[model samples]
Target: MEARLDLAGSPVAGKALKHFIAANTALAGSTLPRATRELVEIRASQINGCGFCVDMHTKDAAHAGESALRLNLVAAWREATVFTEAERAALELAEQGTRIADAGGGVTDEAWAKAAEHYDEDQLAALVSLIALINAFNRLNVIVRRPAGDYRPGQFD
Candidate 1:
């Protein structure tokens, strides 16, 4: 498969993506745990069928020592036992946030309350921003038909 456009080669895309990439960099310094952030990204990418992102995040998470068991279970986290309550809360929020179009009311109050229970305000802010960020990345990659399975860990870094 081939991408519709070369985001790296296109000055217009590069200009737009620079800000998105910067936002992601800032979120990396936030209070949200790296593992949790990767899990959220992976789950959102999966929901969006963005294989390039799924490939990128899964490899990055594994490179950072995320267990294969946990990584594989991200798609089925509700039935998995490898995650903590906090991680579960973040995943739930990611799912709800990513599927907002499917849910009429956006994220449910219960989901937000649960996430709030597990995360401080700053952490919650990071989680929210991460969700939005990953969804944007997913849309970009999916829209362009970016191929998967060639990503290297730290390739973007």
Candidate 2:
């Protein structure tokens, strides 16, 4: 139940986290829709089995008014009727981004084009950066075996 290391207590990780927080602030202000952002974050976390991120993002999304149905159905998003095309595209990109090793070629042209159909250039940039950032957070938490279910909305803020 204990994390292997305290990321906040380590000077190296603390500095990295500061810049990460700043980068996230910049991404938050991007043109990507707030709901889609949360969805992508949660979906990627779930795929990576990063319980800390799943708890954090789900709480944050709910605090921002994301419906419980959508949150519960992120793993089954393809079959769910609760999402828009834009949201679907974002989720597809997140899946591809998170499962790069499985796919063997990273994100495919089809997924990228599907995502491009919905998001503008800036939003696409944000989505790509968000995927990378969330994966980084997921890997850090998963490798450290961070426990879940205790996160509060805005805990990081």
Candidate-wise lDDT, in order: 0.95, 0.94
Q: By TM-score, how accurate is candidate 1?
A: 0.98
Candidate 2's error at 126, in angstroms? Answer: 0.2
Model 2 C-alpha lDDT versus the unseen true structure: 0.94
**Model 2 agreement with the true structure over 34-106: per-residue lDDT tens digits:** 9999999999999999999999999999999999999999999999999999999999999999999998889
User: What TM-score does structure 2 among the candidates reach?
Assistant: 0.98
Per-residue error for 68 in candidate 1, Å, reads 0.3
Q: After superposition, how far is residue 61 of candidate 1 from its true place, in Å?
A: 0.4
What ranges in model 2 sit over 4 Å off? Answer: none
Worst 10 residues of 1 by lDDT: 1-10
